[model samples]
Target: MHNPRSDKPVLVGVESLDNVQQLVRTAGDLADLGAGTVRVVTVAVKRSDSPFRVFSDETIVREFADSSHELLDRATTPEGVTIERDVLVARSAARGLLAAVEETDPAALVVGWRPQEQRTDAVFGTTVDALVERAPCDLYVERVGHEANGVDSILLPVAGGPHVETAARAAIAIAARNDARVLVFSVETSGDAAALAAEGREALAGVDGPEVPVETTVRESDDVTGAIVDEAAAHDVVVMGATRKGSLRRKLVGSVPRRVVDQTDRTVILARSGDVVGGPLHELGRLLRRW
Candidate 1:
């Protein structure tokens, strides 16, 4: 049920068999983040008609080899990491991952975010959207760095409020794991922006802001959308909040996350809310939805 080698910070990779290739690649990439042990806990959905056997035959990943058990074995074998495979014959991707995480209880849950325009983007739809709002542990909503094999500084566009805390906390762990830095930025339109940003930083005081030095910035601007997009373009990864339609004025009006993801080449890690604080990703999402 757990890796006995070392606590060495865990990164839980979640996905259906459709993402086996990506999962294997991500597991290898994360291994380089630290000498610490890495485990790739993956789930293959086993429906009545589409049993686990179907996935076994189609897996292309040499490291993972498509077999859930084999993937976990190989990961822990050559290294200290452990892989736990599951055949969750479930109705949804999120549900399958939720089951795996509950069973595994990894340190930090990592999930890839493929662009929506691609042909295989069905995997990035409401399923992931809901999961982003609800997964266990701090969810790493990744996109670009997976292809590059590593991430640079995490460009977290902060609003200088408690709302950005969840995203900042998640970014801290991810940055530490990836040997990355955190660029905490807040775009100012007017009205004592520095003072306002100080207030926001105060909210983050109690959050788990790992050793990775977080560089906070308060930039003056008139346009919120353009400033955010501009801020997103500078970093290798963009971390922000996905405000609800009823409460998130910026997101509801301009769909800030959708826009940032669209206009920037960097990967977007959209944390839905910080209200739930440091818990599983799903708990935060579920808590926010009630608000």
Candidate 2:
């Protein structure tokens, strides 16, 4: 629990009870990786002034104290891993989280999203949708039901974008930490596996830690969603871009993200423009704030 910031402590913001468990589970995976330690930060942003509110800045600080103590008491939290966690109160939770990213300077931020109960919210959760638009650090938006600890295998589909490399960097860092190999696939009519592998190797070239094995695959079909859905089942997580193309069309033609969320048991990560170092990932950024 030393706190000058180890290799890269994860900054996680959770809003739901479900997210709390998800964050805890993911934190364990991050700790196991030795990429650094995983710290949990649960945040609540309020729209109305209600005393029922527990996320006030001071209140959060106090609650974080209790939560951390309770968290430590449990056998689930690894004994040796460092835990520097907090509860934050902010006018806008997402903005506060991004600010924390700047202030705490974690390598990246992990966010949990359980698709909205209704059809529209399924498109995106309001708060999660906002963080994608504004978060400063790399973001990994995870869906529920991810009970696994290590991301032994991953699928990062290079759906063309300015922030594509951002996703690659995030994936590389993750793979390096977990001692996992990444299968980089881009849904395309034609793409060179050798070339894609080279790109993945290049993207991960300078990151800290041991080398991460990389594989490249290109799937063909008019259906982007089908390709992603099929491959994701075999992997632990899927990091893919969400295009701004008509939702109905993508859904009908196949939205890789929508289907992945709908069909898989694995965690699905949505990376936006600011996260990736390059611009390809920025392609999905366009969808972040749109209606």
Candidate 3:
């Protein structure tokens, strides 16, 4: 199915001018995915001497905003994409982006994902973790350094869930833009390789439009993450769906996508198709409905 939100505006959080190239490239990819406009946002704090200070660092902030737009004009805004610039002066990057999201409810919020020393507590970086938990819209965390190579070869892994269609739709849109191919990989299940292959093909067929070439593979592996990581090395990017609703499944088998993020060298996109739920409270609703 085509993404319902693809034609909506996209909100991108610009970390800095250094990341302008990649950020713009991602915005273009979103355009191919059906985004009508890209709103580039940045955050800066104003310096103030005291409550009596009438002229806060308004000049400095204005200069920053001007420079930001210049950078976007030079490198970020592509030929056919409508671009909007926004600067928010907030305490932190997360707060600034959240403010922008509140003001302009974009279809998806795109942010950079930098690899950092693994903290024992958080699987993703601080900003991403915070946004994933609370963002009002779908979130796309683009891993830096793995710039898409014309979307030449895209990797999408699916076992069985809601995210399968979501990820497939994204891959199809991206591939359609670059005239690329999509490889859909799935771990062996049901102890039947042929059956798995058949199922995988059917799933791919359901999502695969005439826009791009798509292929499917099913392999047996106890280490699901290892298999995906190994396959990801040869692909331009890996798009995986978030399984936020299945806590029981996560507790039992762990999160394959989280592990894949840590091990893969290629760009990883954690695509969420809908609004984030209110954690345990959301789960409670599901339980109550079962009664």
Output the number of the lDDT-best candidate: 3
How far is each candidate from the true structure, as Cα RMSD in Å?
A: 7.5, 6.6, 5.7
In order, candidate lDDTs are 0.54, 0.61, 0.67
Worst 10 residues of 1 by lDDT: 1-10
Candidate 1 segments exceeding 4 Å error:
1-13, 16-39, 48-87, 105-107, 118-124, 144-152, 160-163, 177-180, 190-196, 199-210, 244-254, 272-291
Off by over 4 Å in 2: 1-8, 16-18, 24-37, 44-47, 52-60, 72-81, 149-151, 173-179, 190-198, 241-255, 273-291
Tell me how far candidate 1 lies from the true structure as C-alpha RMSD in angstroms: 7.5
| Cα error of candidate 3 at position 215, Å | 1.1
**lDDT over C-alpha atoms for residue 12 of model 3:** 81
Tens digits of per-residue lDDT for model 1, 9-94: 44555554454444444444343333344555544444556645455423522324446554443333223433444444344566
In model 2, where is the ten-residue run with the lowest total lDDT?
247-256
Q: What are the models' TM-scores? A: 0.63, 0.72, 0.78
lDDT for residue 109 in candidate 1, whole number 0-100: 57
Clashes by residue pair, model 3: 6-34
Q: What tens-digit string does per-residue lDDT give for candidate 3 at 65-164?
A: 7686566665555457777778777656776787787688777788887777755555466666667655667677777777765568888887655455
lDDT of 3 at 159: 65
Off by over 4 Å in 3: 5-7, 45-61, 118-120, 189-210, 244-254, 278-291
Query: lDDT score, residue 40, model 3?
Result: 82
TM-score (C-alpha) between model 2 and the true structure: 0.72
- Estimate candidate 2's alpha-carbon lDDT, on a 0 to 1 scale: 0.61
> Per lDDT, what order, best first?
3, 2, 1
